[model samples]
Target: MSNTGKSLSDQAVQELVAKLKQAIATGTYQPGEWLKQIDVERSYNVNRFTVRSALSELHSNGFLQHVPYKGYRVTEHSLQERIAITEARELIECAAAARVIANMDSPGLQRLESLALEFRDALNAEDRPRMMKVNFAFHRCFNDYCRNPHLSRMVDELRERGVGNANRGWTKRSTQEASAQDHLDMVEALRDKNLVRLQALIHIHLNRWRQGYDSLSS
Candidate 1:
């Protein structure tokens, strides 16, 4: 543990950013709502400097928008931007899934199986939060073998937004079963080294996510 008044690990930074992004996505901090430095400092139990640093990092990454005198606001996405996100996810995730299928390892398979079970449990319990966690875990399970950290990181950043968006979608027990089954299919595909099926399944998974987003506005 390095001492520097407040030394944050990469994981810690990601968690903090995820929390803030979740807040923004869930309307806790509306699109136009001012993200006060003091409020985040007190709420998150950190100093204004940390808040500023985190916010700056997110802003630079296109998750937050800095207003001239009104503090920061969550960045809003248009339908076009949403579609672009979907397309980008399809390309990256499918490519990663292909790689995972091509270079399947025992550890990766074990991790994917574990994540699939977690997703099933979350789905059975109809727990959106847990399901969200499991869903990302499942994606990362395969993405870890991608051999391209930068691509994997991009998928992760996009997924933070994807999960937030998904939170607003209908996550009833019935919906949960379908989503969970999708995860299982993806895992099975990867485990069998079915590249074509894995790619298609990954594309469908992302399309479903985007469909949920589209349903909101319509």
Candidate 2:
């Protein structure tokens, strides 16, 4: 369906994709779990065509896989792949933070602050899903100010592929309280418009995850 005349089509697709992505991130789909289109349609309360479209979108975005006879499943990434994804994301986000500080207006700054607050609240509440959502939102706010549409789009796609791997696998050792502290420090850096500190904070953020993953492996 085209977005031209549809008021809710885009909204519905985004909502459904978020829900499904969250489920996958939290292991609801599990490794190698095959997802039937009919089951997804019923569970999401969307039409068959909508379900198909959403699934296709997810697949194209590296969140889902198709097996010739086995249907669709959540795609899995190896630790090495996860590390690469995290590194790439850090590059984009850290640079984006610097650019945003140099470009975005007051209103844009407020939006970034709002996202950081929401992420902190989610961490305080120990809500993993909410934390992930708002954490991504904060990065997105920075990336939106990147001024390059292609760069913004690439960061978003990388985020989708990295969210589950980053949040679930790489951060298993980071408690909610610890993550909250990290978010607070990041917000403080952003509020001060300290690009150097912002870059450092993002490095710490990703390094913590890498440490956690390495610890798990050892």
Candidate 3:
């Protein structure tokens, strides 16, 4: 392929990767569901090479697991693994809370508040897909204020991994309401530059899904 062709192919692969990741994250592709390459190609209308490359990227990112003599399957985390991931997220996000507060400006705070309100509206309407998207935006916006690209990237990766594990905590109205409130509270904490309160909210927000997951497993 020519350089231009290569660039287009790379872009196609990246787009496919993002689409597949979103599908997996939103539970359209359930945990442990096998993703056949041909089906993926037909579904996404991509070529064989693109599908393979995208699957490989997702596997590298811990979103999918490759099976010998079989295609990729969505990775399903064990309860213990989910707990461990929650703990890790708590540590990283809480530690970054101070930096995020220090770096947060008026514009950033307003953006976060907007996203938080959007999330609450999505929750009220019982729009799961919109809720997922806005919830991610709210948290991502807050984390971006940490002003450390590497740390922010780490948080993104861990968050994607956790979301990929089919955290179904949001199915309950009560849980969704709590999450909505948590986002608003987090925004308030940032606005007030309350590092301690923000850290506490982070812990609660991160573990809410884990608690729901544990309940389901029990």
Q: Which one wins on lDDT? A: 3
As for candidate 2, its clashing pairs are none
Number of clashes in every candidate structure?
0, 0, 0
**Model 1, backbone clash pairs (residues 3+ apart or across chains), number:** 0
By TM-score, the better pick of 2 and 3 is 3
lDDT of 1 by residue, 1-218 (tens): 56653456544566677789756543456444567889887888876656877898889988788988777877766656766777888888876776777777888788888888888886677676666666767777678788788888888777655444444343445556667787888878877888899888877666564444555435
Compared with the true structure, what per-residue lDDT tens digits does model 3 show for residues 68-167?
Answer: 8998999998877877887888899999999999999999988988998998888778788888888777778888988999998788777777775535
Please give the RMSD to the true structure for each candidate, in Å.
4.2, 3.8, 2.4
Ranked by TM-score, top first: 3, 1, 2
Candidate 2 residues 43-115, lDDT tens each? 8899876787788888887799887877788888887887898789888788777776677777876786787
Against the reference, the lDDT scores of all candidates come to: 0.71, 0.72, 0.84
Candidate scoring better on lDDT of 1 and 2: 2
Q: Write down the TM-score for model 1.
A: 0.78
lDDT score of model 2? 0.72
Q: Where does candidate 1 clash, by residue pair?
A: none
Regions of candidate 2 where Cα sits further than 4 Å from its true position: 1-33, 169-175, 215-218
